[model samples]
Target: MDKITIQNLEVYANHGVFPEETALGQKFLVCAELWTEIRTAGRTDDLEYSINYGTVCQEITRFMKEHTSRLIEAVAEQLAEYLLQTLPLLKGITLEIKKPWAPVGLPLDTVSVKIERCWHRAYVAFGSNMGDRRSHIDSGIQVLRDDPAIRVGSISDMIVTEPYGGVEQEDFLNGCLELETLLTPMELLAVLQKAEQKENRERLVHWGPRTLDMDLLFYDDEVLEEPELAVPHPEIPKRRFVLEPLSQIAPYKMHPVLKKRVKELLEELSDRE
Candidate 1:
């Protein structure tokens, strides 16, 4: 939750919509607020324990100069992602890109774009019921692991379970995983859907069977309800396959909507059965 601030660092870069702006280049001001744990660095007085502001400043300068974008918003967005990916110790970033000397023939101070980006903890439930089920699930996990924007964490053991929804299909190999990602909820969903598509997942039959199934169960204790997505996976409490593996990895993780722990939900479901 602690922060290190870098204010108004000037850089010369070529980033604008107009031809003159890109050809001749212009001066830009960048500001950054780095969020991380500074307690260890503060106590040990070791530079290694903390993020080096000097190095970060240089990185900002280099990134600004190297990338050319049509708008400051794009510049800020790309720069924030670059810094977060390259800097291991940086947990979050607030970035601002200021473009002064506007081409508009008016008396204006400057144009700027500011944004906040951070890592989010998310849990995903994966399963497969057809065609080398284990391999399909494993491949899906690997795809997530390989992505730079995602850091795969503790994974629950895969369990065999009967098919849900009375689909009269083969048993499924189901499991859950913990991951840290910089992608937003929607973007994360796209990544999971991509992995499923690679294995040729079809939606012809509702919960009937599939090559691979990836469900977004939770994201950072946040509750979301959209047309295509639902956080805490609306059916978490009722799905034994989801809870069994999820409890193994996150027994104490509380459901933001239901206000019950994973282990508690599992126990409650067991009592009913």
Candidate 2:
């Protein structure tokens, strides 16, 4: 990745815990590292091919002056998000918000919060066994398409699959999705849960019929086992519906834990069953 480093841009803003800090205002210094591909820009010597540092500096100055928050943390987060959204060529941002004149009443260098935010690739599984199954899946797709940070890459043709669990239910329409997103794994989960909730998904009957079902099957080859969520979805490798859709977009993608490509795993599972 190519780098564009903008360091210690000065801004006069009102941001602090104390009321006086907001009232009197203070100086803030910001540093940002914008990541992108600069090969074309370098070859052509064109501003259009690469991100314009001058424009970014102006943007930062304007944003800091116009948007005032109580904490620099919030300022940094919003600014990073803004930069990512506004700069089409940028892939990631490392933002450092410095508060030099913080009212700590001690000899100190500076107080700042630094964060690295970037887009992530995620795979989602969609299913519905209840009324208007196709509509349910379509609605979910629309929601993802509507979001700015989420880009729908590819979708597998919906396949009718028999119910997996012991509980008897109607056949489900299942498929997988490939998404490029700026949302973290947890944030992506929230989006999925929100969509499910919109469809009135319930936990009443385990694996029972539902209006819409969405699950996070994989997140950037990440493996995590938390209380509320699991990554690489635990059973995705064993489920043909998951593997089939996933293989469509990322057939050769290797599992972080299993060390096998999605297509290979799908073939193995098919051989057994």
Candidate 3:
């Protein structure tokens, strides 16, 4: 990735814990590293091919002054998200917020918070087995689409499949979609869970049944495991329901661990059957 750096751009803002700090605004220094391929811009000598540093600086200054947060961490976090969402050409950012006016009652140089954030491509699978299955899936997708932070991409056609996990249940209408999001893995999971909650999904039975089921199948070839979440969806290869719909949209998408495309995996599953 090529780089465009804005070093120590100063802004006057009212962001702090102390009442006095907000009452009397202070100077803050901000730095940003815009990550993208600038080759086109350089070659074409066109400003349209690149992110305008002047525009970005103005936006940053305005954003900082408009939003008030007690912690610089919040400023960095929210600002990073804002820029990524607002700027189409920018792929990532490393932002630093320097608060030099901290009242520590002692002479200190400066206090700052820096963070790096970027957009991620993710694939999510959706299923619903109980009552009005298609509507459940469609409605759930609309919910996800309503969020500006979530850029919903190609959605696979719905398919009917038998139950898994040896549980007696109605046939499931399963499908998947691709998305571009500025959310982290965990943050994406949290958002999905909240959407499921809106559908009244319950986990009383494992793979038993649900009004809406959303699974995080992949996040930019990332493999991760936590107590509550797993990436590449551990059992993707075993679930034809997932693969069939996934094939419609991302047949050539590869599994990081298996090193096989979705179509190949689906074929493998069919061969065993």
**Considering every candidate listed, which one attains the maximal TM-score?**
1
Error in Å for residue 165 of model 3? 2.5
How much is 212 displaced in model 3, in angstroms?
A: 1.0
> Model 2: per-residue lDDT, tens digit, 60-82?
98998888898888999899888
Q: Whole-model lDDT, candidate 2?
A: 0.89
lDDT of 3 at 202: 90
Clashing pairs in 2: none
33-81: candidate 3 lDDT, tens digit per residue: 9998889999999999999999999999999899998888998999999
**Cα lDDT of model 1 by residue, 1-273, tens digit:** 999999999999999999999999999998999999999999999989889999999999998899899988889988898888888899999998888877889989988899999889999999999999999998999899889899999999999999999888999999999999999899999999999999999999898999999999999999988998988799999999999999999999999878899999999999999
Q: Per-candidate TM vs. native?
A: 0.97, 0.94, 0.94
Question: Could you arrange the candidates by TM-score from highest to lowest?
Answer: 1, 2, 3
User: For model 3, where is the 10-residue window of minimal lDDT?
Assistant: 135-144
* Model 1 poorest ten-residue lDDT run: 95-104
User: Runs in model 1 with CA error above 4 Å?
Assistant: none
The Cα RMSD in angstroms, rounded to one decimal, for candidate 2 relative to the true structure is: 1.6
